[model samples]
Target: MSVTTRVYVARLAGTAVFDPIGDQVGRVRDVVVLVRAKGAPRAVGLVVEVPGRRRVFLPLTRVTSIDQGQVISTGLVNMRRFEQRAMETLVLGELLDRTVRFVDGSGEAVVEDVSMARQRTGDWLVDQLFVRRRPQRVTTLSLRRRGATLTVPVEAVTGLAATTRTQGAARLLEAYEDLRPADLADVLHELGESRRLEVATALDNERLADVLEELPTDDQVEILSGLDRDRAADVLEAMQPDDAADLLHELSDEQTAQLLELMEPEEARDVRRLLEYEDYTAGGLMTTEPVILGPETTIATALAQIRRQDLPPALASMVFVCRPPLETPTGRFLGVAHFQRLLREPPHASVGSILDSDTEPLTPDATLGRVTRLLAAYNLLALPVLDAEKRLLGAVSVDDVLDHILPEDWRESHDERLDEEASRG
Candidate 1:
């Protein structure tokens, strides 16, 4: 059989790279491909990782043979640093796990993996894409569906090249928009360290913030610690104050302090306040991003803000009327305007005239049991947490309260689901 039909890129990724005389050069870190208008992209070179040295580019033409888990080279390696060019694509880094739309408009799928082969003309081609279709959901819980894998030529897909290749962050997030944060976090957690970092590097601060919020504390710490200081600060700033505080509390005091110093002063202050509360208290479980509005704000305006911001379902259930500092903890919290109430009233009606101030707000130090009773008795989705002076600190959602009441092994059950996915793969 010709080399083109013999081996796959996945199998060659970690193979040893050796020189002509059998001297160890390095190991294959990534495969570089030059994308073109038609046909599979031409594999241009290999990114070789040498211990205690920068990654270097090894041109494919200099490769003698790939046999028995070893890549024999012609002793003509490029010592210059391997910076990816405009047309070059890193198969392992960029192509794997990417989502592409079918050119025929049938549907979209994720590239679970890929296959490549060397041509008779001494060129390597990306021969096939191993795609996994989104599983169909059944109305019943008894029957589970598994994702089906499809083998397709790269030419039949769109949304995974050009702009997607150059701006990897956008492409990485495009396929995952439909997923809930918890599901997305599960996917990221199952990936190996290198691949996890590759995907993380491609997500913007806000999107990464949502995913990190759903991850376990240990995984959150690991991912945050791995990022550069500036990016880490930006991501932390984007997270809800309670989530950010919980993650920071898992780190050593020194690490926490360092990150806090890098964060925006206002956001840092909010996190600091949340950190002061006991982990089991209402303040600790509250999110600072509540839908607060002024007393005189019109019902239509409040509704518009909720729609424009795309607030979480819990927070969007109601709007709190407050004095100032709309985005963070602020002045006197007057009352709340429920979504259902907004719909009943005229658009020009002021929220203050129809506020629901009947439910007593919870104090910062309120116990989880107290919070649960207050929510259950009043049938409320969220309850505001206030300070001694009645300032709106944040709001504890029903979901956070449920997290405490649920069994401790709830997370383990979630991980088992991912394990089943791996088994199926």
Candidate 2:
């Protein structure tokens, strides 16, 4: 008959990663230990936090064995890195300066620092680590006590156990459930392109919509490329109209039509109409999915609607007061109100009474130059989009405009310029 053994966290659930064979490599921020009734206990996965470096996993193949209640690996299968830390092991010290990332999107945030502290279990364990930026010296480590903390609860972690036992690339989708859209976006941005797609494949349409708004346009395309036409259509349909239009602009006409066929008739038409506009122009960037109500509506009614949508208080600062009229010139499009003015007045007040006459609207022909200038004028995130007849077609965000026109090419250009200066000197 076969026998089994028990395995638990070495000190705390979080420990600094290190090279088992090297004098110093890095620190372990996360570790997964595996055990089965039929086999030996072993360390399955690892994330080492080194000061100011990208966090990379040690593929499971590099592991030699598991003993002494710890993971044993010869060295990183790729190249070797070393970092310095106080009160760590050869295994621990090896990982000192290597980078590590927790649950953020895309690739590893370069590791800035690792921290250890006493847990309620009466043992020392990893507390929090972080990726940091320096005031000078480009990107560097931030290992101070204040960095490296995450708000996510332990209950929220999905596949941490299996991830630890197994090595190679981790699919975070399998490990986490229902992350906030912003949080999910941050994770996707940090993951590599391939892994980003892997996680995107796991999200539901609404969640996809939420995170889709937060990603840059290129990343939205990357995530869309991973889905089939039907799934892709569902994702687009669920998104805020402006965000969906941005992604559609990136797809080829053939791919666009194919995905459109899978969308609901209403959404497909809305997206199609937006696609007809020049992508870089304001008309192309405006969102058609904004909340609108009649000018006659009461604050109490608007407040009820806000509660139903579960919008945060900050967003309530100005709910758009829409006309909702169906007459010629689409009278519904001409109405407007600010949330701040509403809250300051009595609950029974009419939207028109509190409407900020100062609000300035934008037309489709506007350029990015004009858009930025107008945003500065209104100090607004949600701005109105109107047709020639002054009929409101949609709303545009300051973020959408910037994400569209500003190419990531700048980062590469800067890198090249640095190399050139180095060569010239």
The lDDT for every candidate, in the order shown, is 0.76, 0.54
The candidate that wins on lDDT is 1
Clashing pairs in 1: none
- Which window of 10 residues has the lowest lDDT sum in candidate 2? 1-10
Residues 316-344 of candidate 1 have per-residue lDDT tens digits of 88998988766556889888999999999
TM values, all candidates: 0.60, 0.57
Candidate 2 Cα outliers beyond 4 Å, as residue runs: 1-171, 189-195, 307-317, 326-334, 405-425
lDDT of 1 at 157: 91
Candidate 2 lDDT over residue span 1-425, tens digit each: 11112222223223333466544444444443332233222343455533433233554345444344344556753322212122212212122222333343322332233333333433333333333322222234533323333333222222222322112222234223434566457556655555467567767788877888777667888889888878888998888666787787778988888988989988888788788788667788876655567778888777666565534343344556555553212454545566665667889987766766567777887887788788777677667777877777766777676666676543113223323323100
Cα deviation in Å at residue 140, candidate 2?
A: 55
- lDDT, candidate 2, equals 0.54
